[model samples]
Target chain A: MKGLVIVIGRDLRLALRQSADAWLAVLFFVLTATLFPFGVGPEAATLRQIAPGVIWVVALLAVLLSLERLFLADFEDGSLEQLLLSPLPLEVAVLGKVAAHWLTTGLPLIAAAPLLALLFHMEPAGLLTLLLAMLLGTPVLSLIGAVGAALTLGARRGGVLIPLLVLPLYIPPLIFGVGATESALSGLSARPDLLLLGALLLVMLLVAPLAAAAALRQALE
Target chain B: MHRFANPARFTRIADRVLPFVAVATAAALGVGFYMALFVAPPDYQQGESVRIMYVHVPSAWMAMFIYVAIAVASAVALIWRHPLADLAAKASSPIGAGFAFLTLVTGSLWGRPMWGTWWEWDGRLTSMLILFFLYLGHMALMHAFDDQQRGYRAAAILALVGVINIPIIKFSVDWWATLHQPASVFRLDGPTIHPSMLWPLLITAVGFKLYYVTVVLLRIKSELIAARLRALDLARLKAS
Candidate 1:
């Protein structure tokens, strides 16, 4: 448990030092969300209607963009190999790294989502639902993306490969997240959708670390 | 199963099985296509367009079935380090992708006439599309690594992660209000499909499964051969 905290602290410190990475993800999220209105037309009604999907989809893509860097630096510097040699189980270390990833990238996306939501003319109730959904959903993204990042370590064209690997896995969360926000906008209870997102987060929390550890072992070998 | 893990033994067994599987696949497909096209009566509402079900449903079934097979094989490989299991998982991906692609194309063809659009955000269709992308991702990851062993292990982990989608695809229609019809076959109460339509669907599904078996065996055999050739080349280089 202590080791896990140390791993998380170390990663968080590193991420803090290089804050641009987190900012880049936020910038990408805002930019991608901004493009939707131009692409679909400037009508506020149209933007409001599509806002849940547009924001969630672009947030997913932004999360994907940051995933490639999740393990690459550690792997390159041989710290990953050293960390694997430590007494802590690889899965715990993976959890720590994923936690840091969520903090750095996913947290920022959540913070930026409402402003983007406003730009899309999302209602206040819908914005809260979006915030709630993003809170539940983005950690799942970071968790799953860690698996993809770990798997692609040392692979050729890993940056291009990570999205192909992670995006399909992102579908369920995207569906539920957007569903929650849309339901909120339409005056229905968002409970079911939020619960489903929560369920996905729990499943990914249990599964992703183990899978990522296994992949990391394979990559190191 | 362990006995056949030896490549030489596996090859011999596969060689014997291949001819039989190939012949059976061709015969079943021939009969299945004939039955699907002529013997099965058209839907009263859908008319001639219902013929697409013969291919689309079977392909969709194979798409899910093959992913399950890959996941199971991957589990075997990861747990037991079965030499042939990874090869089986890797070899089966393209064929699975092909089945998934066929499902999408045929579904689209059917949708155009039935739904009046080339596409719909129908839950089943969207889930199936996601399955197709998962297959593509698995295939790409399998070959992405320079080390075959690493690639196999990485892709194996991916296959297990993706197994979650199979159940989702299977139940998407029931879970969501969508244009795609809910499960008519494989229900707890029993299949709702009429016997006339069911027979051809069953026959084609069997044909597709047999086809998958035949191709998988062929692919595994070639993969084994390629591995051997690489080993020999490396050994020759060392001697020189």
Candidate 2:
């Protein structure tokens, strides 16, 4: 636990030093949301209706964009080797990395989501659901994306391959993520989708890190 | 399984079996097409358009069938580290993807005539589309790594993870109301299709299954030879 915390702190401190990375994610989130209005026309009614789905999609993508970089820098710098060799259980260290990743990318996106929501004229409930889904969904994304990143560590064109490899698995989350927000906007109960999202998160939280750790060991060897 | 896992053993056995498999495949395909195209009675509702099912349904069955093969092979590779299991996983992917592609094309054809559109967001079609994408992803991941062994291992893991999609695709039509026709071949009490059309559809499905087996075996043999050549090349380099 102590070692995991130290790694998390080290990762967070380094991430904060590069302000552009975080801001670029925000820029993408906003720009992607804005493009939809133009593509589908700027009519307020359409934006208002599609707002929840649109915001959820962009938020998911924004989270995905930064996820590859989770272990990438460390993997390159050889810190990942240290982490693997450390006394701390690889899974705990993995959880720490996922936590730090979500802190830098997912949390900020959750914070920025409501602003995007208002631009699209979303209901407060939908905004709430969007934030909620992001909170649960992004950690799983980080975890699952870690496995993808680890598996593709030495693969050529990993950048292109990661999303293709990961996105179909990403669908279950997207289904429930968008579904939850859509329900919230309509003032219907969204618990089923939310629960399913949580269930997926729980499962990935358990399984993905183990998978990631194994892949990481193989890549390093 | 381990005895056959040896590539030399596999090649010897497969080389002898290939000709017989090829002959049977050609014969079955001819008989199946004959039954489907010439002998089958027209559907009262779908008329001639129903003929699409003889092609589409079998490909759909093969699509799902091949993934299960992949999943089983991956399990064997991961648990037992069987070289042939790894080869089977690699060999099965393209055949499955082709079957999926056929399913989509024939489905779209059937949908256009029956539903007055090229496509619909029906449960069965959408889930199958996702399955197709999964196959593409698996194949891409398999070749992504510079190291052949690592790529194979990662791809095996991917195949196992992707087994989840198979059930989802199968049940999607049942779980949700879909514009695509409901299950006609395998059902609770009996098949929904009449006897005349049923015979052709069943025969075609067998033919497609035989075709899948033939292709997968050929692909695996080729991959084994390629791997052997690579090993020999590395050894030659070392000796020099």
Candidate 3:
């Protein structure tokens, strides 16, 4: 537990020191969301209807953009080897890294989601649902993206490879997240969608770190 | 099972089995196509366009089945570190991708006449598309590393992660189809499907499975030979 906290704190401090790295995801999220209106035309009703999907999709892409750097820095600087050699279980260390990733990237995406929702003229209930859905969804993204990041460690063209690997896995969350917001927009019960998102988050939380640690072990070997 | 893990023994057994599998595949497919096109009655609603189901449904089945096979093989490779298992998993992917592609194309062909568009964001089609993407990712990841073993292990891990998506694709498509459109054009699960139609579908499905087995065996054989050639080249380099 102590080791996990220390690892998380170390990653969090590093991320905070290079704050631009975190903001870049947020900026991309906002910019991409802004472009959808232009591409689809500036009609309000259409934007309002498509808002949930557009937001979720761009948020997915933004999360993917930051995933490459998750393990690359440590792997490059040789600290990943030291961490592997440490007494802390590699899974715990992985959980910490994933947590830091969620904090730096997922948290910011969630924070920025509402502003983009507002720009798309989302209603108050829909905006809140979007926020809630993102809160549950983005952690799942970080967790799964951790596995992709770890698997692609030292691989060629990992940046291009990560999205291809991760986006297909992101479909369920994307469906449920957008479903929740769209439900709220239409005055339907969003509970089922939110519950599904929560279930997916819990499942990913359990599975992803172990898989990532295993991938890390393979890469290290 | 463990005995067959030996590649030389497996190859010996597979070489004997391949001819049988090939003959069975050809026979089944020949009969199945004849049955599907000539014997089975056209749908009262869809007319002759219903023939596409024989190819589309079976290809879709192979698409999912191959992914499951890959996942199981990957699990064995990761847990037991069986090199043959790794090769089997890697060899199966492109075949799976091909099946997925055929599913999409035939589906689009059916849809153009039936659904009035070449594509629809309909759940089953979208899920199959995603499955295709997953196969592509697996193939890309398998070749990404310079080290063969490293690439195998990484791709194996990815295969396991992707196995979760299969169920989601199945259920989401089912649920989405049910919610948005109550009666799909083709109803395979309904009691209304006649045995004549059913038998041809079953035969074609079995044929596709046999074809998968035949090709995968050939691929693994080639992969083993390739590995041997590489070893010989390395040894020759060392001697020089």
Candidate 4:
């Protein structure tokens, strides 16, 4: 448990020290969201209707963009080998890294999502649900992306490969997240979508770390 | 299982089995297609366009079946360190992708005539689309690494992760409101399909499975021979 905290703390500290990576993702999120109105026309009703899907998709992409460096730095500098050699279970270490990723990239996306939603002329009723859905959904993105990142660590053209490998897996969260926000916008109950997002988070919490750790071991070996 | 892990023995068995599988595939498909197109009564509602079901449904079945097969092979490769299992998984992916592609194409053809559109974002069709992408990912990852063995291991992990989609694909129609119809063949009670239709469907499905076996065996053999060629080349380089 301590080791998990230490790993998370270390990753968090590193992320804070060189903050541009997180900023780049947030900037991408905002800029891409800004493009929707220009491309789709500035009609308020149109933007409002499309807002949930647009935010969720861009947020998913931003999370994907930040995932490349999740383990690449450690793998390159040989610290990943040390982590593997340590007494900490590799799965826990993986989980900690994923958690740190969520804190840095996913949190910023969640914080920025509503501002984009507001710009999209989204209704106030769906605002809270959008935030709640992003909170529950983005971690699932980080977790699944970690597996893709770890799997492609030493592979050729990993950047191009990560999206192909990760995007299909991203479908469930996007569906539920957008579903929650849209339901709330339409005055329907968002509880079912929210609960499904939560369930997805729990399932990924168990599966991703094991799969990522396995990929890491093989990559290192 | 371990005994068959020997590539030479596996090759010998595969060689013996290949001729039979190929012949059976041809015969079954010939008979099945004839029965499907000529003998079986047309659906009262769908009429002639429903004939596509014989190909579409069986390809869908093979698509899912081959993925499950790959997942099992991946597990064996990861857990038991079985080299043959790795080769098997690698060999099977493109064939699985082909089946998935066939399912989509045949489905689209059937859909255009019946559903009045080439596509819909219904649960079954959407999940099957996802399954196709999953196959593409697996095939892409299998060739991503410069180190072929590392690629195999990475792809094995991916295959395991992707097994989650199988159940979702299987039950998506039931879970979501969709334009696609519900399951007809496999049920707790019995198949809802008429025996005339069911017989041709099963035969074509069996033929598809056999065709997969024939191609995968040939692929694995070529891979083994290719590895041998690489080994010989390296040995020659060292001797020089």
Candidate 5:
């Protein structure tokens, strides 16, 4: 238990000390979101029409960009090897890492999202739904992305490969996230989509750690 | 089963079954197509356009069927650590993707006549398209690693998780209001399709299944041989 906490603490501290990375992830999110209005056009109505999807898509990309960093840094620096060798169960360690990853990458994106939602002229309801959806959804991304990250450990061109391996799996969350916000904006009940997103998060919370641990074992082997 | 879990043993078994399965698949395909094209009566409503249903529905059936097969094989590989099971799962992906592509193409072809548009965000069609993309992603992930075995294992877990999406795809139209046609052949009640059209659809579906079994077995055999050649090379390297 202490070991898992230490792992989480270590990840959090490392993220804190290396403030540049957090800033960069935030920058990536903002820059990407800013680009969406331009790509889709400056018309407020049009932006509002596509806001939910645009925010979700950019959020997905931001999460993807940071995910490889989750395990790659540890694995390359030999810390991951040491972590595996510890008496602590790898699954516990994985959960801690995932939590830390979500804190660093996922939470910031949610905080930054409301501002971007404003750019899209998204309704206040759309913004609230987006935040709720992101809160539930992005941790699932970190959890599942951990699997891809662990799998690609030590593989050639893994940086390129992780997104290819992980993005298809990302589809479900993108669906629920956009759906929740769109439903909210359209005055339909967002409850079903919110419930579905929660269900997805619950599933990832259970499944991803074990799967990621197994992949880590294989990668380290 | 454990004793025969060896790649060599798997190859031997696959070799013995390959010829028979191939022959059976060929016979089924021949008879199934004949029945579909020649024996099956024109639909009272759809007419010649109904022919697409023969190919489309069967391929759609295979797409979902093969994904479940892949998931099962993946579970076996992950749990029992069966060597050949991973190959079976990996080897089956491209074939499944092919079936998915066929489903999409034939669906689009059929759509043009019926819906009067090439594509729409209809529930059933959109979900099927997503399923197809998932297959493509699976195959891409398999080759993503230089260590092919590791990639296989990773992809196996992915294939297992992705199975959850299958039911969502299957029931999408029912769950949501979409422009796509509702289930006609498989429903709570008897098939809505006419008996004249029903027989060929079922026959073609079976034919496609047998065809899948045949091709997947062949792919597994090739994978086993490839593993053999890898082992021999490793042995030679050690000896040198």
Candidate 6:
């Protein structure tokens, strides 16, 4: 428990010191969301209709952009090897790193989501659901992305490969996340979608850390 | 299971089995296609288009079956460190991918005549597409790393993680198709198979399975030889 906290705190401090990394992801999210309106035409209804999908996808991509660096720095600096040797279980450390990653990257994306939603002229009723869905969804992204990052730790063409490996897994959360907001927008209950998103997050929480840790072990070996 | 762990023994067995499997594959496919194209009565609903099912259904089955096979081989490789299991998984993936690609194409061809569209985002089709992407990811991850061993282990873990998609693809139709039909996508329930149609479908499916077995045996044997050649070349380089 102590070790986990320490790892999280260490990552948090590192992220704070180099805050541009997190902000760049938020900027990318905002920038990409802005492009959709241009690509699809500037019509308000069109943007409003695509808002849920747009927000979810851009946020997902931003999270992916940050994931490649999650272990690379540690792996390159020898810190990952030391972490492997630590008293902390690598799975716990994985969870901690992923938690910190979510704090840095996923949180910013969620915080920036509603602004993009409003930009798309999304209804106020759906705005809260959008935030709620992202709150549940982005952590799953971080967790799953951690596995991809770990798997591709020393991989050639890691950047291109991570998205190919991770995006298919992202489909469920994408479906449910957009579903929740769209349901709320259509004046239906978002409860089922929210619950499914939560279920996916729980499953990934249990599964990702172990998979990431195993991949990390192999990469280091 | 470890009895077959030696690559030399496995290849010897594969060589002995290949000729018979290949012959059976050719015979079954010949008979199945003959029955399907010539003997089976045309569907009242789909007419000649129903013939595509003989290919599409079996390829879909093979697609799922090969993924499960890769997952099992990966588990063996990861758990027991069986020497040949990784090679088997690596060898099996492309064949699985080919079946997945074939399923999509035949499905598209069938869709064009019956649904009046070349594609639909129906649950089964969407899920099959995801399965295809999963196969691609597996194959790409297998070759992503510089260290061959690392690539094998990492891809093994990925295969195990991706096994979750198999059940999802299996059940996607039941779960998603009826829940909502998008305005753009068409949903059609499959027709019940008459025994006459059933015979050819089953025979074709068996033939497809035999083809997979024969091809995978050949692929694994070639992989073993390739590895041997690489080892010998490295040994020569070191001695020089």
Task: Give chain A TM for each model in order.
Answer: 0.98, 0.95, 0.98, 0.99, 0.97, 0.99
Question: How does model 3 score by TM-score?
Answer: 0.97
* DockQ of every predicted complex: 0.63, 0.44, 0.77, 0.63, 0.43, 0.64
After superposing candidate 2 on the true structure, give the runs of residues whose Cα lies further than 4 Å from its correct spot. B165-190, B231-240
- Give the TM-score of chain B in candidate 2: 0.90
Answer with 4 or 5, whichever has the higher TM-score: 4
Docking class of 2: acceptable
Name the runs in model 5 displaced over 4 angstroms.
B168-190, B231-240
lDDT of 4 by residue, A1-221 (tens): 99999999999999999999999999999999999999999999999889999999999999999999999999999999999999999999999999999999999998888789889999999999999999999999999999999999989999899999999888888878888898899999999889988988998999999999999999999
Clashes of each: 0, 0, 0, 0, 0, 0
Candidate 5: docking tier: acceptable
Residue-level lDDT of model 5, residues B1-240, one tens digit each, is 578687777778878988888888888788878888999987666678878888988898888888898999898988888887888888889998899899889888877877777775566667777788778778877887787888888788778767864564345334443322464422213656677778788888888998898888888878777777889999999999
Off by over 4 Å in 4: B168-190
Cα deviation in Å at residue B179, candidate 1?
A: 10
Q: In model 2 chain A, where is the ten-residue run with the lowest total lDDT?
A: A167-176
lDDT per residue (tens digit) for residues B1-240 in model 4: 899988889889999999999999999999999999999999888899889999998898899899999999999999999999999999999999999999899878987877778985556666778889999999999999999999999999999999974564345333443212453321212567899899998899898888998999999999999999999999999999
Per-residue lDDT over B91-126 for candidate 6, one digit per residue giving the tens place of the 0 to 100 score: 999999999999999989999987788897777777
Global lDDT of each model? 0.88, 0.81, 0.92, 0.90, 0.82, 0.90
The TM-score that candidate 6 achieves is 0.96
Alpha-carbon deviation at B42 in model 4, angstroms: 2.3
Best by lDDT: 3
When sorted by TM-score, best at the front, the candidate numbers are: 3, 6, 4, 1, 2, 5
- Share of real contacts kept by model 1? 0.65
Candidate 3 residue spans exceeding 4 A from truth: B176-186
Candidate number that wins on lDDT, 1 or 2: 1
